[model samples]
Target: MNAIMVMELKKHVQDRGLLFWMLILPIIFTVLFIAMFTANTDDATRQQVILSIVPGYVVMFVFFIMISMVSAFIKDRDKGMTTRVASTPISPYFYLLGKWIPFMCIVIIQVIVLFLFGRLVYDVPLGQPIILLILSIFLTFTVTGVGLALAVIVRTENMGIAITQIVALGGAMLSGLWVPLEMMPDFMQAISRFLPQYWAHQAFQDAMAGNIVFTELMQTLLILFGIGIAGFVIAILRYPFFLKRAVH
Candidate 1:
């Protein structure tokens, strides 16, 4: 299983397009965001803005990462790679974990890059960036799991691409990516609570606020865990439909 995962990581790195989005795109957006936002805001206002914006950045990065993961799965299916894997002794869970390795590395790199850029250039204080890193990783577990399930559930690559963008954009908007929850319309704020992105943003926000409430924190963590587990369950149950042979 470990060998299979390593081979999957190697294959992903060799795929230039996938590697570019996973490694380059997020950093580009994050840098551009800092450039645009920093040009005019006062230092005091900047700190508060950072408090709000960091969570959004985390969410955006995760969204892109999920898209990359789902796209890779689609590519594997097209190339008959998944069928070959299915013939092996590997369980679906092991196959899934192996597939996730590259995205996990990309997510870790994104978090580290954001921390350095935020601290060095923007003067955003992250007391201990490690906490933020851990939260980002946990959130990826949920996002990647959901992405895999989508790959299994969708019939065509083109359809999966459309669904990927919709899910990412919807989650981002609902999680207050374009605007802060406190300032958004009341109904929107109410709707955001039902999305995984909201729970993820909440976890990051609480870590940044420096005053952690155990109940709030636990609730958010549980929600993310449930989402991840649920996605995995659906994928396993619907393997016949998701697997190419089932369609034939």
Candidate 2:
């Protein structure tokens, strides 16, 4: 089961389209964001803007990473590969892990790439590299569960793509991706409170500020954890096995 899962993971990574979605798109967005924000800023303004963006970027980062991972699962289920996986010693959880491990690695790579680019090109201060690393890992794992649930529940690749985009875009914006929670409208802020992206962004914001307060960070982490758990439960309980049945 482990061997099959590993092979399957490798096969997914080797695919050009999957690789682009997992790694390249995030990198592209990171560069574009940094460029646009820093273009007209003074030294101080550049630093300020970059610092502000850290949290939102983290949210968008995890969101985009999920798109490829979920799509991989959709493609497998579409092609009967998921059924073959089920017949093997591998269980649904193992299959989930197989899809997760690679994308987590991609997220880590994206973090390093973006962090360095921000520092060198945008003059963004690199604050506590260790903490940033830990934050990135935590965010990646949390999103993996969400992606797994999305893949399991979505009936078609097209629908999966649509759902992920909607979730990603809406969640990010509501969670203060385009604007911080403090600055957003009251209704948007209220809505953001219910979404996992809000808590995830909160975590990044707290971490970037160097607050390092365990209790505060835990609130955000716990909220994201709760979301992941709920999604996983739904996916496990409601996961469809038959293509025809799943469609209707």
| Candidate 1 global TM-score | 0.87
Minimum summed lDDT over a 10-residue window in model 2 is located at 239-248
TM-score of each: 0.87, 0.84
Maximum-lDDT candidate: 1
The C-alpha local distance difference test score for the whole of candidate 2 amounts to 0.68
Look at candidate 1 and give me any clashing residue pairs.
none
Best-fitting candidate, scored by TM-score = 1
Give the alpha carbon lDDT tens digit for every residue of 1-248 in model 2.
46755776677667787656655665576667767877977987766666667557757766776667667777776677777667677676656666667766766776667666666765565455666676677677667777777777776777777877888888888888866578888999899888877776666655666665778666766776677677667666655543333343
